[model samples]
Target: MRLSLLDRSRTRSGYPEADALHHSVERAAHAEALGYHRFWGAEHHAVPGIASGSPAVLLAAVGARTSRIRLGSGGVMLPHHQPLVVAEQFLMLEALHPSRVDLGLGRTLGFTEQVRRALRQQTDDVDTFASDLEELRSYLRREAPVTARPVTQTVPSLFQLATGEGLVTAARLGLPAVIGGPVLHSPELGEAVAAYRRDFRASAETPQPQIIISLDLYLAETEEQARELALSEAWAMARSRETGEFSPLEPVEQIREQHWSPRTTSRIEKSLHRMIGGPAGIVVPAVERLLEITRAEELMVSTSTYDRDALAQMDAAVADLLT
Candidate 1:
């Protein structure tokens, strides 16, 4: 299976926020050396735990650091900006990096109401999103009325960050789908993917349905050690639901020192349960089962932890397992 990474530039408690971006760039270079297929940056506005608010800008920095691994957004939330402007920004990335660029678009609005207001995303109309995608594709394909310049010969591969109805939109548009969260664990996942493939309309760019399963995955010498590595992210997620702020990741020992409510404990367990973490013997079969169930073409690891060194080790281990 093709292996990729989705680095959110996660900020840790003891470090400055800027460190997260630098870490992400460093991680991209590391992944390239390890033979990863693609390295993607995520967009999260006003989130304390995530430093990257602009995938395009982060990708330019990543492109400067790495030569081979494909760079793209994991993705860019389309409702926040004009389609033409998005087209121009990625077109410039394509011009600089050539065929090493991919565009993963999402329909999500800002994280909260205030963020939405700040982004001026007033509506969540599905039709508008579909139209904007078509418009953006026109610019990328050089078929729009006005050009989005630095016009390159190839368009960046388009993917839809999808769930539920988003899968239908991807099928209609003939684009690849990247799915994660509860949908990946849901009992209906097989049916949903089968439906997506059955209804997919092929285009010259994508002749068949493609799915990329994205989720948190970590590896270590033992199951206990791997779960410890994943606990930091699980604690952060649990706290986010309670405090309404996704705070920076903390060390596992530090997390254990804090008092946890029953709800928080339950949330943390649920989060960890959703993720795949363990030694290669345990993780590989689980991952293979997922790939078999969905017929997915790629696995996008979105794992993050407070220990950067451990995280890097896990990345290398994952590369060894998949590549």
Candidate 2:
């Protein structure tokens, strides 16, 4: 299978934001060296744990640090920005990087109500996501009634963050759908992928439908060690859902020392179990099962850990598995 990466640029509990940004660039270069297909950065706002607030800016930095590997947004939250501005930023990136940039658009709003207000975005914006996407495409293709700045080349690829609705929308627009790994585990996987394929309309850019599965993945010499590396982020996810603080990642050793209520413990365990990890013998089969079900053309792995070195090691191990 073709393997890729989506770096969240996670900031650990004691680390500064700069450290996380630097780690993202370092990870991108490392991913290139490891022969990963693409290195995507996510877009999150007002979140302490994630530093990728602007995917285009981070992608430009990553582009300067590496060559060959594709650079892109895991998704740019489409509802939060003007479609024209989004197109221009990515066009500029593509101008500098040539055919190596991707524009992955998503419809989600900000993480919190305060953030939504800060962005001057309303909940109603979600309804316009499809129209906004069409507007963005018009500018990219230079077919719109209006033009922003001059766009010299065509946008490399347009990707939609997959939902059942998103899968259908992507097909209608001739864009590839990037499905979360957890979505593939659902009983609805067959219908989702098949519908996308069957309903896809051929456009000048993409003649066929494509699906790429993005998963949280890690691998270590032992299953126990792999799970340990995954604990901090897993706990952070569970805790943030319960508390709404979205704090930075804590070390696994520190995490283990703390006690949780039964409900909290259950949340952590469920999140941890949902993650894809362990030695290759275990991960390989699970991945195969997913591919059999979803027929995804590529796998994009995302992992966030307290230790940068361990994260890189885990990345290398995943790369080795693909070979």
Candidate 3:
């Protein structure tokens, strides 16, 4: 299976938020050395747990640090920015990194009402996501009314970070789809993928339908160890649902010490169940099943934990398993 990574630059409770960005850069260099296919960064605005708000800027740092690994946005939320500006930022990245950049676009609005207002985004802005994507594509292909700067012969590869109706939009546009979250586990997933493939229209950049499955993955020498590793992220997710604030990851022991409400406990259990985490004996087969079902071209690992060392070890182990 082709393997890649999506680092959200998650902040740890004890660490400065700036460290998350630095960690992402260092992790990109490490992923390149490990022979991963791509190293993608995420964009999350006004989220306390996530440090990266500008994937373009973060990828610039990553590009300077790594020579070979593909760099991309895991992705850039389209509702918050104008299509032309998005094109220019990624065009600049393509100019610097040449053929190593990918533009993964999403239709998500801001995380909260305040953040939405801050970013000058409204709920209805999502209505233009498909058209905005077409405009961005035109700029990348140098076919728009106003060309994006740093024009080059090669354009960064484009992928739609999608679910539900977004999948239909991706199919209509003939772009690769990067899918994750609850939709992956839904009973309709197979039908959804089939429809995406059936409805895909050929385009200059992508002649065939492509899918990349992304999810939280954790690995360790034993199931217990792996569960412990995955708990940090699951806990944070559960807390965020309850508090409406996604805070930095905390150590397992710290999390264990805290009282968990029934809802939080249930949410954490569900989150952990959704993620693939265990020793190779377990994770490999689970991943294989997912690939067989989705027939995806790549597996984009989007795992994060409070322990950086453990996360690095997991990355190496995953590379050994997949690459």
Candidate 4:
């Protein structure tokens, strides 16, 4: 089992966003030292809780700090930026880091109308996602419709962060993909992975179908402690859905002390159930089942916690299980 990590550089209550950003670079170096295969960062805009606004810049920081592990975006939302700018940013990353960069792309819009206006992005941008991806690919291959400078054949491996029709698009384009969250725990997973493999076409870059499952994972010595470790993020998720704003991760004790409505309680419980937690006995079997169903080539865990030390401990434990 190949194991990797997806760090969103989540901002916590008492810490500065700068710390979250620096922690991402530090975590990538730690992951490399721990023998993890890849370390992927995320891109989020207008989301105060997450500090990773630019995947290219964040990845450059990680790339400079780490040598062995593969570095890339969990995804850069394609709808938000120009294809050429995206290409140049990542190409510069590849140029600096050599063969260790991965260009993970996705089609997602801004979280709010205000954010949409800020990015000059609209919901209709999704309709052009496939065409946009092709344009980016063409630029990388030096076959663009318009001439561009810094012509080089060097390109990073492409991976799509997708589900449903997006998964099929990735297959048609012959790119590996990452999918998980609620879908991994649902019946739709088997069909989704199967369809991705069945409809896949080989391209010169990626010759075979490859799927990587990404999930929320929390592991601790006891189920109680593990659940506690997960509460901050779980509460944040519930609050974000119920309210318009996504707040920073709170302390476990603080979360427990809050008065929650039935709706928020249910949302928190649902978030908890979606995550894989507890001891090796519980977590290992769940991971095994996920692997059996998806038959994915790799697994990536997106973990959030207030305590960096506990997070690192959980990561090391999960890494041991993968071995």
Candidate 5:
């Protein structure tokens, strides 16, 4: 039972990057010492809600700072970038980190079709996404059956990052994948696990099913404090449902400032059910419940604390669970 962290690069109510990066680098350094096995950062472009815009740059910097913990994208949405460019950049990263790098590919543009058009991609994007993923896989295998220009032979291992059917494809392709969704709820949990395991194909790259799942977190000193953090994440989750993905941490005061009809609050609770409370006594049990339900290979908890004080408390609670 390994416990890892996912840094979604939340803006923390518009915290300065100069400060956040300094804190993140220092925090990741501490995470390495604290025995966290892997630290996954994320990427977002044109989203003021998240600060994790340049995942590659951040990982490289974090890679330089620490030597042991594995690092990579919690996911780089495949539809947004050229597969060739991704292969080359990751190849370079592999040259630097070797076995320490992990690539999780999501099929999203990470936004809407309107934004997809904004990114200059076409309607055929999702249709071509799978093939593009295969191209990236073929390049990494360093053995494309055909002689193709723009081959990727640098990275030794590349894993697919997906949820739903993409998880099944990752199995068929025999790549390690992390299975999850923009949200985690419902009995779809068992089906998702079964889908990945049932259709697993033995390929030259991998012979067994390898998987991971995201745990929406709120570990803190007191249950009340935990609920407060959950409130912030819940707010983000509600916004994502309306706006497409997780937004920055809103000032709870500001959120309270808005007159939410009872309808909105009920809608949010129905969606983000698992993202409540702290680890003081409940963290381990919530995780155990998740594991009992999903039995994922790894657990990546998502936290939405506003500042270092909250992060430190959450980190310690998580550390206690790890020990």
Candidate 6:
């Protein structure tokens, strides 16, 4: 039952950088004090609102301030950067923090179509993930000797098995596995977990498959608040998913005005149908049920919302659970 922070570093339109950074640092500190097990980030490109373009750099700053919590990416969208450069950066981070880095990888393009084209990462970008991931693993094995750049002084060799092909390999390779895109009742997700379990093997370096799942967690004081928050978050996701449009956090009125028809609501409900409840409504109970289902070694909760109160309530729910 470890808790962590998952943020896109969203800010209000026309906000100052220093002001937003101050709030983000404070939120990070607050989550730390609340006994969360980790603080992780996501990667988004050309998103005007999300300030978290550099997850590794932000994690380093976060790691410098926190003594106990683990710092890592919920995912570094793999197609954007050279895997060798990423591996080197993360290797340096591992050198700095020693046994405290987590690298979650993903193949999905995290940028808009225009930006993707600009970055030369189109639909044909699958090979980048495969090649880069392989190269990174090679670099981490430290067998192919190369001129090592100055290491970041941490030795966290906890490589994340991030691909669909590699979730099963996590068992064989003894690296931890993380799988998202879990539609609660989907047999597809079940098959994925089953595949991973079947391929799981024990090695001298690591004996067990550490599986982590990301779920949209709604935790608030009441169900109404939870729904409101979830709607806001869901709307934000819907906007991102529907249009390539990204912007600063819209005001409540503006967000509410974003058209929602039954069809779109159904789509959203289908997208997040697995998660929708308050802390008392389902945070612990839902997590407990998910654990019983996936039996994952860990659960990484991602609460997507532009509302600061909703964000803070996530920390609050974790606090209440601990209390």
Best by TM-score: 3
lDDT of 2 by residue, 206-269 (tens): 8878889988777877778878888898888888988897878999889988888788788888
Q: Root-mean-square deviation of each candidate, in angstroms?
A: 1.1, 1.4, 1.0, 1.4, 3.1, 2.9
Tens digit of lDDT per residue, candidate 5, span 1-323? 77677777667666674555566666677778878878887876666567666677788888899998888787777777877667767766777887787787777564566666777877654467678888877767665654334333445455677655677778778877775555246567777767777888877767888767776677767776666666666777676766576666776677778766576687567545666465446767776777776667787765656656667667766777755
Residue range 205-229, candidate 1, lDDT tens digits = 9999999999889788888888899
The candidate with the higher TM-score, 2 or 3, is 3
- 193-235 in candidate 6: lDDT tens per residue? 7777778777544677666766677777777677766665555
lDDT of 3: 0.91
Q: Write the per-residue lDDT of candidate 4 for residues 93-182, one digit (tens) a residue.
A: 888888898988987778888998899976664388899898998888888886444555567888999766788899889989898666
lDDT of each: 0.92, 0.87, 0.91, 0.87, 0.70, 0.67
The TM-score measured for candidate 2 stands at 0.96
If scored against the real structure, what TM-score would every candidate get? Answer: 0.98, 0.96, 0.98, 0.97, 0.87, 0.85
Misplaced by over 4 Å in model 2 are: 124-126
Ranking, TM-score, top scorer first:
3, 1, 4, 2, 5, 6
List candidate 4 segments past 4 Å from native: 124-126, 146-153
Clashing pairs in 4: none
